[model samples]
Target: MSTRHILLGLLAMGPRHGYDLKHRHDERFPQARPLAFGQVYTTLQRLVRDGLAEVEETGSDGGPERTMYRSTDAGARELADWAGSVTPSAPFVANEIFAKVVVAILSGGDPAAYLAAQRASHMQRMRELTAVKSAKDADLTTVLSADYALTHLNADLRWMTTTADRLATLTAEVEST
Candidate 1:
């Protein structure tokens, strides 16, 4: 995730203080890990330094003063380009689970048992996500995010099942190597 690009996009909407930006980011991306307050301020400072954003105003209603930031013309262009770009799809499969399975077989460990435990873990997470998606009060964003996660989890479950079925062949191949 490009924090810079995301902040730029938010600034494009209008001038915003770090607090407002952080809150809005959380509201908009509920499934994402929440942005830390310090992270938000740090990223905003970097954006201003890079000329992608600038301080539009500084004021206070009654409390401490706040610096409001707005996206610059350059920032707008950058945000547009980033939004238009396509993310690479599975350029490499650097799967930790697969690596662990191979290592277990080489070490004379039980790859089958590891796969079984992993499958159970994955299933539990899937159920949790399903409940979130099925909630009556769930918004479109929550449902969509849950669906995305569930799809990936389902794929992983299928892969684990296939790998478990082929463990005998895999073990023999590893021993031969």
Candidate 2:
């Protein structure tokens, strides 16, 4: 995600200080992807360096002095363009267990145990996600999307298990050659 663009958009909503931006970001983050304070501040620095945000002094009496930020005209233009663009979805989906199983098999080690553990974990996660969907009072569109994502995850888990089984069998056969 373009944290810079996100920051710009947030600032465009109204003038905000770095602390306020971080607070807002933390509130908006999903449970699956939490935002860290460090990340929020780091992105703010980058935005300042890029001239996308300008610092200002607010006379509001809110305890200590706060350095407020306002999005520049250039920043607003960039934010609009970014929002309008339809970029392809990210491709690097991290499945650490799946990757580790592949590595163990390639290294001539037994991957059966790891693969089995991964299957159990993945299925458990799928069940949990399904339960969340059922237990929530979300809109129909959101529930449908969640169901689709859960199904995709389940399919990927099945594929990983099948691939691991084939690889283990093939490795055993190759060793006997």
Candidate 3:
């Protein structure tokens, strides 16, 4: 999901500092898949540049106050528009990871090693996707996209497991002089 709507949503709630926004986003989106602070600030800057959000000084922090962001009327309107927009159906594109695995197998690189690394990565991804799926506040639009992506990861992990086992069996059978 693009950060545009996320920023707007944050501002829609009330004025918030950059850190506050990031924290709230993490709380909502889950830290396992948290948006980076750089990403949140960059999007916030873009929102300010777009006139969708404005930085305001807090009147009473009782110390050095930080810049807080509030959504403009236009921002609220934009958020509503975004919320009403239809979810577009898109085709999944091929990823380089699978290509790398195929190349490794064809090039006589040890399939066990390749699959070992791939399984580790895929298992981590699966955990993250599972966390996202279970999160209550996760936007379904984003969640469904993640779900589709995880389906591909699951398929690859299955292939890697099977291939690793088969290759290990074959490697064992070959007499090493």
Candidate 4:
């Protein structure tokens, strides 16, 4: 996720303090990993520097001072453009597991065993995600996120099987190198 753009999007709602932005982000996109306080401030600082956001107010309520930020006109346009732009399709093979399999074969290790173990790991995670998706009490956003993950994992399992089926050819190709 684009943290900068997300921050801008949040500011679009209204001026918000840094603390509010982090909590709001967590609530809004539960699927994403939580952001750190430092990251929040750092990104906000950069946004302010880049003319995308600005401190609209500064005040203190008997404790630490708070600075509320709002999106600049440019920030709104950039956020809208980012929201509308099509995300380029990432290469399916551009993943650690694929690289691991290739490296294991290149290093003269048994790719079959590696593939088996990796497949088992993927299946285990899929079961966990499925359980999350199946939960009746799950938040709709969380359930949808789990479903998305499960779908990708299903595709990965299919690829694992295909790669295993062609392991012999793959082994030969690696040996030739």
Candidate 5:
């Protein structure tokens, strides 16, 4: 994920301190891995250094002083370009699961057993994500994120099933290599 671009986009909304940005990022992308505090500060600093953002203000209200950041005009332009651009879809399938399967076959390990375990794990995650998406209080953002994850997991599950069905052929090919 483009952490820098995301921070720039967030700053484009309004001035925000690191703490606020981090929390807002979490709220906006609940399915994403949570941003670390240090990561936020580091990314913010980089944005400032790159002239994509600047410190709008610094003040304290009976607490540690907070530096509020805002996106620069350049940052706004960059965010617009990034938002408008389309992400490439499956340009290459560099699948770790495929690699592991090949390795297991080559090493005389049980690829079928590994695939079974992986399928179980994927099913469990899909169940959890489904629950999150179907929760009574789930917001649009949360539901959308869960849906995105579920879609990917579903694809992975299909791939695993296909791979399992061809395991014997795959093993023969790997062994020949």
Candidate 6:
């Protein structure tokens, strides 16, 4: 989940301890899974190892030493590079379902049946995500996340129907190859 870039961005703000990084991450990424302390510390150690970050200070004031970390120049460059990169609109070139359909047609199986099954699955997932989005007590972030999932599932449902309709043609094309 680009944890390295996330941590580097946080460090760019200012020096922070592992605990602070966790807190900031939680607040910033409400829709994301919570970061565990072990993960945070492990990623931080890797950042240090890679010369992307450094321990700025270590507090030992009669308590557990809190190591404050800051991003190095290299970390800033990495963050900028990630930020500038443009992901394609439809980046499902390696989609497993597409592969399955091709394989089914190649093996003389029913790609239409596979598409039907996939449509059913996508519909069920959309129903589940719709429930989450429509919950009375759901927060904005949670609702947004559910909505995003629903949109993708809806697109998949459309693709399933379209593919099923053209399965015969697809099978012919595959047979020709």
lDDT of 3 at 141: 59
Looking at candidate 5, the ten consecutive residues that score lowest on lDDT are 163-172
Task: List candidate 4 stretches off by more than 4 Å.
Answer: 168-177
> Better model by TM-score, 4 or 6?
4
TM-score for each of the candidates? 0.87, 0.66, 0.56, 0.82, 0.82, 0.68
Model 5 lDDT, residue 71, Cα: 93
Off by over 4 Å in 3: 31-45, 55-57, 83-92, 109-152, 158-177
RMSD for all candidates, in order, please. 3.0, 4.5, 6.4, 3.7, 3.7, 4.6
The C-alpha local distance difference test score for the whole of candidate 4 amounts to 0.91
The CA lDDT of each predicted structure is 0.91, 0.77, 0.80, 0.91, 0.91, 0.87
Shift of residue 38 alpha carbon in model 4, Å = 2.1
Q: How far off is residue 105 in model 6, in Å?
A: 1.4
- Comparing candidate 5 with candidate 6, which one achieves the higher lDDT? 5
What digit string (tens of lDDT, one per residue) describes model 4 on residues 70-143? 99999999999999999998765588878888898789888889899989999999999988878888888888
lDDT of 1 by residue, 21-117 (tens): 9998898789899999999999999988988999999998899999999999988998999999999898678788989988998898988999999
Q: What TM-score does candidate 4 get on C-alpha atoms?
A: 0.82
Leading candidate by TM-score: 1
**lDDT by residue for model 2 (24-74), tens:** 765554332555768877887777788888877666586866678889888
Off by over 4 Å in 6: 12-14, 23-38, 49-52, 60-63, 72-78, 88-92, 136-144, 168-177
Worst 10 residues of 6 by lDDT: 87-96
Ranking under lDDT, best-scoring first?
A: 1, 4, 5, 6, 3, 2
CA error at residue 86 for candidate 5, angstroms: 3.0
Q: Residue 88 error for model 4, in Å? A: 2.7
